[model samples]
Target: MTKNILISGASVAGPALAYWLHRYGFTPTVVERAPGLRGGGFAVDFRGDVHLRVLREMGILDEVRRRQTNMGNQVVVDADGGQLAKLPASFMSGDVEIERDELSRLLHERTRDHTEYLFGDSIASMTEDADGVRVCFEHGEPRTFDLVLGADGLHSNVRALAFGPESRFIRFLGYYVAGFEMPNFLGLDHTGLMYNVPGLGVNVGSAGGKTDGGFVFPSEELDYDRRDLDAQKQLVARRCAGAGWEVPRLLEAMWAAPEMYFDSISQVRMPSFQRGRVALVGDAGYGATLGGLGTGTAMVGAYVLAGELAVAHGDHRVAFPRYEERMRGYAEGCQKLAEGAGPFLAPPTRFKIWQRNQMYKALSWRRLAGVFDKMTTKAARNITLPDYRPAPRSAVPRESA
Candidate 1:
C-alpha cells in the first residue's frame, strides 16, 4: 500500500521533504497557509559539510551555488553611517549566502512537478485513529493520511494542533525580527551596512543580493502576539524609534511594504520532535532563528527523515523513533549555539557591545580566526547521515486521489 503523508508549510522544509518522500514511493501533499509562494526575505546560508553533502546528493548544489548572493563586504557603521569597521563579506553572511526566497523557489520548483500542492489552505482540525489521521481543512474537503509532518516555521499551525501551545516548546531569545521589501535607499552595492547602538536595535541595509532589506529588534522576551502583525510592527518601531541613520527610513518603508514578516526570534525545543503519527522537520521542530543553523538543519532533517522511512519500509513505530534518536543530539547542539549567540546579537549593555567589538578585532589573529571557525564548524558537523541507498525508481507511487 502507498503511504500518504500530509506536509504542512511550503517553505524550505516542506518542499524538500516532498522531494525525497516522492522519490521514496510515498505520496506527499503540501498545504501552505499563504495563498501562494512567499517571496522577499533576508538571505539564508548552508554551512558546514553535512548540508553541502545533502545538496550534492539532491543534485542541487551547483544550482544553489549559482544562486548565491556573492555579497562583497560587510561594514559596521556608526549613527551617522560612518564605517567603523569593514570586513570581508564571508565573515558574517557565510561562505555562501543566498536570498531566502530564491532558495525557497528553487526547492518549490524542484518538488512541484511531482508533489501535490494545496495553497491558501490549512488544517482546521486533525484527529488520529488506529489506522490513520483524519484531517479537516479550513478551505478544503476532509481527508485521511497515514502521517502528518509540520515543516512550518517557528510559529507553526500544525504544531499548535498537535503539541501544546507554541510557548510551551519555544524558547524566545529575547528578540523580535521584521523583514520587508523597499527600494535600496541606502545605495548599498554588493555589500551590507549594519549599525548598532547599545541597548537599542540593529538596522541593516543591503542591495546587491535582493531588492528588499530588513532590520532586527532584539528584546528581553517573546511577549508579543506571534500573529498580530500590527502589534509586531509597533514593537519594532518602538524599539528603534530614536535609533540612528536609516532606521526611521526603514520603519517608514516597512509600513508601506505589501508583504511584511514579523516574528519573535525563538528556538523550538521539544523533549521529542516526534509525537505518534505526527513529526516535525525543520524550523517547526528546532529553529535557532534566521542566522543560526535553521536552514541547514532543516535540509539535513528532510534527507534523514526520508531515508529512515525508506529503511523502515513505512513503519512509523520504527522510523519515527529512529529519526528522533539520530537527529536529536545534533538539534540540541544547534540550539545551544543560539543560546550563546543571543547576547552577542542583542548586547544589553555598552560594555557587552565593546567586548563584542574587541572579540572581532582579536579574530584578526589567524589562530583566533581558526578557533572561531572550528567552534562554528564543530556545531555544524553534528548530524551523522545514514548511508541508505535510494530505492529503485520503479517503486515511485502513482496518484490515487
Candidate 2:
C-alpha cells in the first residue's frame, strides 16, 4: 500500500495536505526550504460551500472565522486620491477572509504532532522505481517514499525536476505583481484604496498597523534570477518609477521593507498533474498567480486528494487519476477567472480602465449589488465534494518510514 508520502512546500497546501493524509492513516513528511514558517503574505479568503465545508471538516472553520480580516469594500481612486468607484467587499474579501500566514499556522498546528516537517531543506532529486521512489534532499540524507506530491507554488522545484522547466507549463498573462508592507501613513481603517493609470496600478491599504502596499503593471516576459531579491526589487522600482498618488511612497518603502513579494501573474497549464508515482496539487498543478481564489482551491484540493487516496485503499493508480478527474473542471473554472485578472486590475489603455471602473460603479447600484456578489463566487461554488470517511488506522496497512 502507498502509505508514505512526501509533500513539498510548508505553505497552505502542504500542511493542509499533511493534515488530511494523517487523518487517512497515511504518513506525510513536509519539506520546506525556508528556515521556518514565513509570514506576512496578503489576505486570502474562502468563499462558497465547498471551501467552508472542507475547513469545517478539518475543524478550523470557526477558528478561521474568529481571526478573519473584517475588511470593508475598497475604493478606486484617481491619481490624486479622489474616489472613482467603490469595489464591493464580496468581490474582494469573499465570505471569510484571513491572512495567508494565519491559515498556514493553523494547518501546521493541526498536523505538527503527526506530520514530520523538515525545515531548511529541499528535494534535490527524485528517483522512482517500481517499488517506491528514492528522494534526495539538498541538506539531508537520502530517503524513500511510496509517493511524492508537489504542493509547491507556481515555480515548483519538484515540477521542474519531475515534469519539465516552468516555461513548458507556465502561461504568462501580460503583467507582473509585487507587494510589501510599510508604515500606515494613509491611516486606513479596515479599508483599501486603489490608484491606477493606464497599465500601472498601485494599492496602499492598512493591514493591522502597516501599509499593505501592492502593485500590478503590464510587462512582457523578462529574464531575472528568482533567488535575487535585490535585483527583483530594483526591477520593480525601474518599472514603477513614476506613478501618481501613494505609489512613490510605496516604492520607496519597498526598498527598505524587510519582506517583499514579486512574481509574474501567470497560470500553470499542465496536461496531467500525475506522472508515475509523483503527483501535484494546488498551484503546482493548475494555478493562477493573483485573484484566482487559489487559497480556497488549495484547501479543497488537499481534501480531495487525501480523501481519494483513503477511498482507493492507498492505491496511487486509482487515487491519483480520480483526484485529478474530480478537480480538473473546478480548477479550470477558477483559472479561467484569473485569465483576465491582469487586464482587469491593470488595464492597458485609459479607455479600458474607464470601462473597468464603470463596471464596478454599475455593480454598486441597488439590485445589481446582490447579483454581482453572487457572480463573484459562482466559480468557487461549482464543485461537489466527496464524503470521505477514512478507515480506522488499525484497519489500514502501515509501512515503516
Candidate 3:
C-alpha cells in the first residue's frame, strides 16, 4: 500500500524527507507555518564525505558548492577593534558553507513538484489509532495519514502534540543567541569580525553585500514571552547594554532590522524518536541549538528515515525503530559538540574569555588545526549509510481515503 505521510515544518528536514518518500513511492504532504520559504539567516556547512555523498545523491552538490559563501578568515578583535587573532576558514567553514535559507529554498525547489506543500498553516493536534493518524491543522481542515513526521525543529509543535511538553525533552545549555540582518555598515567583504567581553560577544559577517550578525550571552533559563518580538529585542538590548566595539552600532541596527531570531542555547534529547504512527526527524528529534552539526545531521536523518520506511514497506512498527537505532549514536555525538560552544563563545568571566582566545590562536598551527579537522570529520562520518533502492512500482501499496 502507498503510505500517506504528513511532515511538519518545511525547512531542511521536511522537504528532504518529502523528496525521498516520493522517490520511494509514498505520498508526502508538508505543512509549514511560515507564509512562504524563509530567507537570510546564518550560514551552515556540510562536512566530510558522508554529507557530501548525500548531497550528491540529491543532485544538488554542485549547486550548493556554487553558492558557497567562500568566506575568508575570521578575525578576533579587541575593544578598540585591534586584531587579537585570526582563525582560518578551514577551521570554521568545513567543506562548504551556504546560507540557511538558501539551502532550505534549494531543497524546497527540488522537492516541490513531487510533494504537496501547505504553507501558512501548522499542525494543531493529532489522534492515532491502529491504521493511521488523524491530524488537525490550525488553519486547514483535519486529515488522516498513514504516518506523521515532525521535522519541525527544536521547539517542534508536532513533538509537543504527539509526545509531551517540551520541558521533558529540552535541556538548556545556559546561553541565549539572537541573529539579525544589518546593512554592511562596516563595509566588510567575504569575512567576519568577532568581539568578546566577559560574558557576551558578537560576530558579524559580510556576504553578498549584506551583513549577518548575532549576539551571544551567558544566562540561566530566562522568563520571557516566546512570541513577543518587541520584548525579545528589549531583552537583547538590555543584556548587551554598554558592550564595547561595534556592539552599540549593531544594537542600533538590530532595533531597526526587519526580523530577528532568538532562542536559548539548548538541546532536545528524547528517549525515542517515535511513538505509534508519528515519528520525528532532524532537530525535532535530536538537536542542539547551535554549534551542533544540526543542519547536516538533519539532512542525514531525513534520508535515513525515508529510506528505512521504504525498505520496510511502509510499516512504521518496523521502520521507526530501525531509523532511530541507526541515528541515535550519531545524533548524540553531534549534540555533544554544542556542550562547549556556550562557554567558548560567551565565557562567564573575563579570565575565561582570555583563555579561550589564546586557545583559538593556537589552532592556527598545522598540528593543532589537524586535531579539529579529524574530530569533526569523524563525528560526521560515524554512520555508514545504506544503499536503499527505490521499491518496485507494483510493490507500492494503495492508501485509504
Candidate 4:
C-alpha cells in the first residue's frame, strides 16, 4: 500500500521530502501558508561532499551551481566605511551559496508535478489514532493521512500542534535577527560590507541586482506580536535608532522593503523527532538559527527521513525511530555551531568588539584561519550518508518524469 503523507511548509524541507517520498512510492501532499512560492531572502550555502551528494541525487546540482552566489571576500568596515579587514569567501560562502528563494523555486519545480501543493493554507489542529492522523486546515477541509511530517521551520505550527508549545523545544541563544531587501545603492558587486558596534551589527551585500541587508543584536527574549509586520519594523527601527555607518539608509530601505523576515536566533532541541504517526524534519526538528549550516542539514534530514520510510516499508513505528537515531548526533553537532555566533557577531561591549576585530585580522594568516575552516568542515561532514537505492522507476508517473 502506498502510504499517504502530508507535509507542512513548502520551503526547503517540505518539497525535498515530497520529492523523495514520491520517488519511493508514497503519495505526498504539501501545504504552505504562503500564497505562493516565496522569493528574495537570505543566501544559503551547501558545504562538503555530503551536501553535494543529495543535490546530485536530486539532479539539481549543476543547476544550483549555475546559480551560485559566487560572493567574493567580505570587507569588515569601520564607522567611516574604511576597510578594517577582509575575510575570505571560503569563510562566508562555503562550497556553494544560492539565494533562499532560488533554492525553493528549484525544489518546487522538481516536485510540483509529482506532489500535490496546497498554498494559502495552514494546519489549525490535528488528531491522531491507531490508523492515521486527522488534520484540519485553517482555510481548507479536514483530512486524514497515514503520516504527518512537520518541515515547517523553527516556529513550526505542526510541531506546536502535534508535540506541544514551541517553548518546550526552543532554546534561545540571546539574539534576534532581521533581514530585508534594499536597492543596490552602494553598487556592491558580488561582495559585502559589514559594520559592527558594541552589541549590534549590520551587513549589506549585493547579488543579482539587489542588496540584502541584515541586522543582528544581543537581546533577551522579546515580547512582540510575531505576525504584525508594522510593529516588527518599529521595533527594529527603535533598536537600531542610533547606529552609525549606512544603517540609517538601510533602515529607510527596510521600511520600504516589500517584505521582511524577523526571528529570534535560537535552536530547536527535541528529545525525539517523532511522536506517534507524526514526525518533524528540518528546522522544525533540529535547527540553529542564522550561521548554523541549517539549509544543508535540512536537505540531508529530508533525504534520510524519506529513505528510512522506504526502507521500513512506510511503517512509521519502525522508520521514525531509525531516522531519529541516525540523525541525533549530527543534528546536535550542527546546533552547537550556533552557540557562539551571537556573541561573536555582536559583542556585548566595545572592548569585545575590538577583540573580535583583532581576531578577524589574525584570521588573515592562512594557518590561523585553516583551523576554523577545518572545524566547520568536520561539523558539516559528520554524518556518513547511507546509500538507499532509488525506488523502482515504474512507480513514477509518466507526467512527473
How much is 132 displaced in model 3, in angstroms? 0.9
- The clash count of every prediction, one per candidate, is 0, 0, 4, 0
Give candidate 3's TM-score: 0.96
Predicted structure 4: lDDT: 0.88
**Candidate 2 on 266-320: residue-level lDDT in tens?**
9999999999888899999988888889999998899889988997888899889
Report the C-alpha displacement of residue 304, candidate 1, in angstroms. Answer: 0.5
C-alpha TM-scores of all predictions: 0.92, 0.95, 0.96, 0.96
lDDT of candidates 1 onward, in order: 0.79, 0.87, 0.88, 0.88
* Candidate with better TM-score, 1 vs 2: 2
Instruction: Please write out the lDDT profile of model 1 over residues 286-400, one tens digit for every residue.
Output: 8888556788889889988987788777778878888898788888787787675546655777787777767766665677767776676677787667766555533432211
Kindly report which residue stretches of model 4 are placed more than 4 angstroms away from their true locations once superposed: 390-401
lDDT of 2: 0.87
**Model 1 / residue 167 / CA error / Å:** 2.0
Across 44-107, the per-residue lDDT of candidate 4 in tens digits comes to: 9988888888899989999999988889878899989999988888787888999888899999
Q: After superposition, how far is residue 365 of candidate 2 from its true place, in Å?
A: 1.8
The stretch of ten residues in a row with the least summed lDDT in candidate 1 is: 392-401
| Cα error of candidate 3 at position 104, Å | 0.6
